[model samples]
Target: MTSRRPLPPPLELPKPGFGRRTPPALFQPIMGLFGLGLGWRAAAGAFGVTPAIGDLILGATSILFLYTFAAYLAKPLRRPATFMEDLRVLPGRAGLSAASLCLMLFAVVLAPYASGLATGLTLLAFAVHVGLVVAITLAILRGPEEGRVVTPVFHLSYVGFIIGGLAANALGYPEIARWLLWSMLLPAGLIWGASARQLLTRVPPAPLRPLLAIHLAPASLFTMVAAGAGLQAPAYAFSALAAAILIALVVSARWLVTAGFSPLWGAFTFPLAAFASALVTLSQGQGAMSGIGGIALVAATLVVPWVAYRVFKLWPGGKLAAKTNAAEA
Candidate 1:
């Protein structure tokens, strides 16, 4: 008997719209670049570095955010279902949460120039973020049993309330920020414990190893919050913890990127920026970890742009959009 050729694979057609094509994962790099700017500003405040350096980075970052946000905002207008659908995935859940955090940070950025607008964005961010967390929780429980497994990005969803606290603190609402930060610690601790158990049991796939970097972000952010609260003892403890985490991650760097570049590289951005900024904050110009912080600041400054370029390139070619397959006529 003659052997017949196997049927061909389906031809894929991508979803429409450049905005719809852009994945939420891209937001992580935006947040990272913004964090880098803030890191420099922290250095300037603590030491004698130029505030202009940070201001320049921040101004550029704002422009980038407007462009990215405008593009992403178009997704919902083009296809609301597609927008909602994205929230079901790991990158979508984490990236959009990062975006909400981005909005909160933007509120602080806009505060000096337009207090009213700043307040409005902060409220909008809070509502959007909390709603996202609820929706994600429900989605995981309802279906897509695949998403139920805990992973490093869970840190972004659960521990990121620190950014809201940071924004509140910046807007002269320290009491509210204090409440938010203190409350955040419980969830952050829970996620860390759960994630550690999962990670220890199975090494994440190569593409996902980069997300392991997210483990460092919460501690770094809490250090800043504790320092702001004048809880020096706690701040020092958190700072030490962040340092150890960073060292461990650095040692594992070879394996983390063994899968090569992916949108997940965005996971590497904010934690380093936060840790660097935290080090600068704790230094208080005393020349403690400021040198190491500067090194991290430089690393982040270089890394964010590279990741942004890689992710944005995906949008231009429609590589980011979902594709549909149909039988050939």
Candidate 2:
């Protein structure tokens, strides 16, 4: 047998609510309120229930609130002491977290312009989105340090949003608007997947792979539909492929869920399955069930915000104050 070196001692995580005077629970309701507000605004927009002015104000305000809170999170994480502690807990996790923050900011500022004409905003947004894509791809290839899981999983959202933007362009949709879709929808699902995967992995006989697929399936559905529509392939063929993939994922996911995984993860999977089925129906030049498909599409759209709300309530920012010390230690 070859000689092996001993590993370094485990790193110390900062105490929960490390520098905060207010209890960590105070942040819970705030995150929930922000989630609810954003969801309400988004739902109103989708159902065409809100006035243009109301929609604009609500959208801008929700973005502003999320931006502000994200900024607040940055302040603490950026500090030398806290930053160092973060580096210790997950080794390379802090760096990737920092990168994720940057990518999130870039997606916000640059995505609008990127999907449109190469106007200044579009150019800026394109640059930012590309930057995010590059950063995330690198992070994945580099791999994470011990006990660090969620960060990589969260970063996958960036990939989904980027893929969405690409699909928007390929499919001849309101291209610029697709960028916004990528910015919002993709990240929420990916982040949830990452967090849930981390939690699930801690159980005996780690169920990491399938738990992850539960989150990945939705975006993949969106991707396959976009591909089917956008590709030069005959419509029937494209639809058939997408349908097959969707069926496979759903079958596998059912087994995984039955094996004792959280249903929350299935939230991401099933909607994608629905969306994929809709795309298959649409592809055959068949509009027989278009109305039903449209309704299912709308419901699938709601999954993200609902998942966002539940996730925030469950483990916003991946913190659980009650067991924080034990878990982190």
Best by TM-score: 1
Task: Kindly report which residue stretches of model 1 are placed more than 4 angstroms away from their true locations once superposed.
Answer: 1-18, 322-329
Over 4 Å off, model 2: 1-77, 80-239, 258-292, 298-303, 315-329
lDDT of each: 0.78, 0.39
Put down candidate 2 lDDT per residue, 225-304, tens digits, no spaces: 34434443433443454445446645765554554432224235233433433353343323643443445445544553
Error of 1 at 30 (Å): 0.3
How displaced is residue 119 in candidate 2, in Å? 6.1
In candidate 1, how many Å is residue 203 off?
A: 1.6
Task: Give the TM-score comparing model 2 with the true structure, all chains together.
Answer: 0.45
Please list all clashing residue pairs in model 2, or write none if there are none: 110-125, 113-122
Highest lDDT: give the candidate number.
Answer: 1
Task: At residue 187, give the lDDT of candidate 2.
Answer: 66
Instruction: For residues 80-175, write the lDDT of model 1, one tens digit per residue.
Output: 766557776777777777887788778767776787888888888888878877877776787676778877777777677778777776767777
Q: For each candidate, give its TM-score against the true structure.
A: 0.89, 0.45
